[model samples]
Target chain A: MSQFLDFIPKIPVADSVEDAMDLLTDTFAGFFDVIKKSGKFSMEFVTDFLVMIPPVLFILIIAAIAFFATKRKFGLAIFSIVGLLFIYNQGLWEELMNTITLVLFSSVIAVIIGIPLGILMSKSKVAETIIQPLLDFMQTMPGFVYLIPAVAFFGIGVVPGVFASIIFALPPVVRFTNLGIRQVPKELVEAADSYGSTGWQKLYKVELPIARPTIMAGVNQTVLLSLSMVVIASMIGAPGLGRNVLSALQQAKVGNGFVAGISLVILAIIVDRLTQSFNKKRQ
Target chain B: MEKIKIENVSKIFGRHINQALKLVEQNKSKTEILKQTGATIGVYNANFTVNEGEIFVIMGLSGSGKSTLVRLLNRLIEPTSGNIYIDGENISKMNKKQLINVRREKMSMVFQNFGLFPHRTVLANTEFGLEIRGISKEERRLKAEKALNNAGLLPYKDQLPGQLSGGMQQRVGLARALANDPDILLMDEAFSALDPLIRKDMQDELLDLQQKVRKTIIFITHDLNEALRIGDRIALMKDGEIIQIGTGEEILTNPANDYVRTFLEDVDRSKVLTVENAMIRPISLNIDIDGPKVALQRMREEEVSVLLAVNKLREFKGYITADDALEASKKGENSVINYVRTDMPIVPPEMYIQDVLGIISDSKTPLAVVQEEKLVGVLIRGVVIEALSSSDENEGVTENVSIS
Candidate 1:
């Protein structure tokens, strides 16, 4: 049986994929350049802006946002202040800022692209059928696989890292948005239509507002997923707390790795709580 | 004037619409069309005209296409093939812009589930139509407030729909449609979601509102009693076809088919019947012209124990019993007025038999069904009971009894 199986023709797999990637990179070289430059500039701006705020003031600001977002609930606010202070004390503040920038860029890009696509999918069966499988592929494919295209398009840097993070984080928001819009009661849509609401009016006034909480949940997921990609993104020259963890791993310094890893956890917890509070405010 | 005229309108849902519609034209049954072409005939060849300021109710059981017919009138569900005319303008052939304009300007709909936007406050929901039409903020706000006030929901204008009860939410839905001040109001089971008591209140309020606004209303309901209570005329549908269209009294007296008869059998007849339907011509003596002997003779001739006494102008005076008339004659009274008793129950001819049941049962004298000040008819206890219980076989008995 082994001999018979071995007699089958060998498939041309690796060379074809490599050649295809090379061709795609060549075809969209200028477009990729523009995206890479814009991406790097925005990422750097956000990082610099975050770094400019003193650690104490930034912690106070986050605590204030948490305080108001939770309708003056003291627990989340105190946690934000303390958790952010602990990260600052760990001496990973600059790396935390870089990670914040990466997550911020990726999540924003994902939401801006995801929502309309989700709405499109909700509105049209053809678009839903075409995009649904694409979303499944994007979500189920290993996060590392996106880095190949990210590198091919934007090259290794913060830009490719942001690109890969966006791909990894986009599917949830899109899927949730489609689900949310579709979940709106049929009667309400009919009422809107009965009132002579245009397509855009119905979407903006009825579908979007009703779907806000669900869409917000998706956005929270996207932000967290972007944050989770920080460690993986560090492999492509993305500088963040993830890079610190990577360096500690290379040097086999357990204590150093633990500190950086804990800082990432603190940031994750703060971001998650804040987004969740924002989501709950409307609800 | 006919505000809306729908002719040969049909709506078939699902694929192979052409085949389904062809089958529909060939008079195929709904089930057959569905099995053959995989299309459900929602409404088939519905034809009707709604007059301005009339509440024309379309009634049927679930899946009977009453809802689909109403939707077709407003072009919400596009007709497979038909013409819908609103004030002589063909709606089915209108472009998107024209249709939108028609919807915004000429018609608005209230939903069974209230269909209020949960995110918006009551005021905001009420102002939706005006806001969509680009009315100025202050103007739309004023109009919306007036509509809310009319609905008795002005105080709750700032509250979200979720915070309000189902009845209040439906009131907001009504106010929202009213804010647009469209020429036509399409209410698709508007009160079907409310508790029975609240539904009664809504129905009464709608009738009161109709009196003031007088807009053409096309109401849809599964409840025959509601249709009878509020509809100026009702169109009853069955199996996607209209079985009958008539006034409540007309339909009750003359049902078009067995389905309509069965559908209406469960309806509370008291709501549909009036004293006019049960009242009989009174045997009366003119008190100004007739003597006590004449009153006694009239009672004896009519085989009644008493005679209703009326003036020369037919204005109800009272009643005179045979004993009183005999006593009056013995006492040498010239007129029956001296013996006439003014304690007889007076009911209007338009009053429902159900309402007059208590009066007739409690009073010894028959009820005087007066129109204006004139004694037109009398409602006796036996006749009212017979009218209430009259079935098809006994219907002629009641009609002949009333005529005599």
Candidate 2:
């Protein structure tokens, strides 16, 4: 029975799937190139500013935002400054700033793209059905699998890293935004309609404001996911502590990997707390 | 002028509205239409006119289309095949822009659930309709504040809807509708969400506001008492069609059909029927000419144990029992006034039967139905009993029929 099962013909899906995908890719060749060029420009512009800004000013800016956000300003500021200093003192300041640039750009682009898509999904069931499964696949696919296509499209640079990070991080924002709007009470919608509000007026004044907290949560998740993709992103020549961690793994250097990993953890904590407080303030 | 007029409006919920409407035109049953076209009949063949400043109630139990009928007036639920004229404009043919304009300027609704925006403060919520219309912020604030004050919610203006009790929240809903200063108010079970006590308070509040604003109102309710208490005219719905439309008194005294009478089976007749409704013209001898002999003769002729006495002005004097009149006649009393018993029950014409039930029960002689200090009618115990009992029997028959 086992030999008979083995003798059964396979679908040969993988071999043909690649051919079909390549044809599909050829069809959208212009669209992909446009995205690649735009991604390159944004990546350079973002990296230039991050690299140009004096490390002290950068630290101060992040620390100042942290100070205002948290009531424990002294503690948050000290933690932030010390963590940043640890990276700077380790001679990884430029690398750290590059990672910051990558994360900032990736998160911003993801949010920009995800929100309207999310809103579109909320507004129409057909869009939601078509987009939702694509999102699920994007989220569930191995992170390493994305690097192959990302590098193929934008070709092994900060742009490809950011493009990959955007794809990886976008789903949460879209999902939550759709959920937030859908969860809004139907009676409130009726009330808005009853008062003679136009569709746009209802969306902006009634639905969006009520859905703010949930959307903010989505944004937070997108940002965190963007940050988490940094290490995997470094394999494609993306800079930062992630690159150091990658190098440490390659050369078996424990101290370099430990410091880089610790710095990433610190950065994650700072971003998480800061976004949370910001979201709380909005509500 | 009629503020709102509906001309055979109907709403059938489905994609095959045209087919469903054709079936409806053929006088097909809702179930048959549903079976044929998968169209759930929401409202069917309704026609009514609400006069200016009238409270026109649409009443039915759940799924009976009261909500749909009210929504149809404001074009919230557009009619499938009929014309709704709001001050002479056919709203069914109106474009979306024109409909919005109509809703903004002419009609505003109060929902059963309050539908107050939870994130907005009471003042902001009240300002919502005006905000939608792009009214100047200062003007809207003034109008919204004025409405809040009228609803007695000014003190809670800055609080969010979630912070208020259900009654208070519904008042915010009321204030929101009122702030628009629209010509018509569509209240879809506006007070039904409240506790009974609060519902009564809100009903009274609405009545008071109606008096003040005098806007045409279309109110929806399942509660008959509420309909009777507030509706200038009520349209009772059954199976998505308006079965009867009449004033409260008309519906009570002369129900349009056995269905309406059955529907009114639980209504307390004593609460609804007035002394004027049940009272009969009194046969009273004028004290100016009627001696005891005459009073006695009048009592015998009327086939009664007692006779009512009145003066030349028709002012109610009292009542003289047949035995007392006879005794006075034997003694040859000059007037029936000496034998007159002043202890009988006397009620005003407008007093509800329930209010006089105690007095009627205590009196041996017929109660005097007086209006402006004049003897208008007499309410005998037997007559009041008959009026109450016959209606009760009718209700009893309806109850058993419905149950079976």
Give per-candidate clash totals. 0, 0
i-RMSD values for every candidate model: 0.7, 0.8
lDDT of 2 by residue, B1-404 (tens): 78888888889997788899999999999999999999999998888898999999898899999988888877778788889999999999999999999989999999999998888999999999999999999999999999999888899999999999999999999899989999999999999999976886787688888878899999999988778878888899998999989877667667889989888887776655567777888888898888988877777788877777889999998888888888888887888777788987889875767788899877776789889989999997777776677664454223222221
DockQ of each: 0.58, 0.55
Please give the range of 10 consecutive residues that has the lowest summed lDDT in model 1 chain B: B395-404
Task: State the lDDT of candidate 2 residue by residue for A1-283, as single tens digits.
Answer: 9899989899889879678768766887788788878877876787788879898998998899888888646888888999888888878887777888888989999999999999999999999999999999999998788887777666777778988899999999999999999989988988898899998999999999999899999999999999999999999998787999999999999998998898888888888888888998767
lDDT of 1 by residue, A98-133 (tens): 999999989999999999999999999999999999
Query: What does the lDDT come to for candidate 2?
Result: 0.86
TM-score of each: 0.84, 0.77
Best by TM-score: 1
Model 2 chain B worst lDDT window (10 residues): B395-404
C-alpha lDDT of residue B237 in model 2: 96
Candidate 2 clashing pairs?
none
Please write out the lDDT profile of model 1 over residues B297-398, one tens digit for every residue: 778789999888889899998898989999999999887776889999899876766678788878987889899999999888888777777655436333
Model 1: residues with Cα > 4 Å off, grouped in runs: A1-8, B270-387, B391-404
Off by over 4 Å in 2: A1-64, A70-92, B268-404
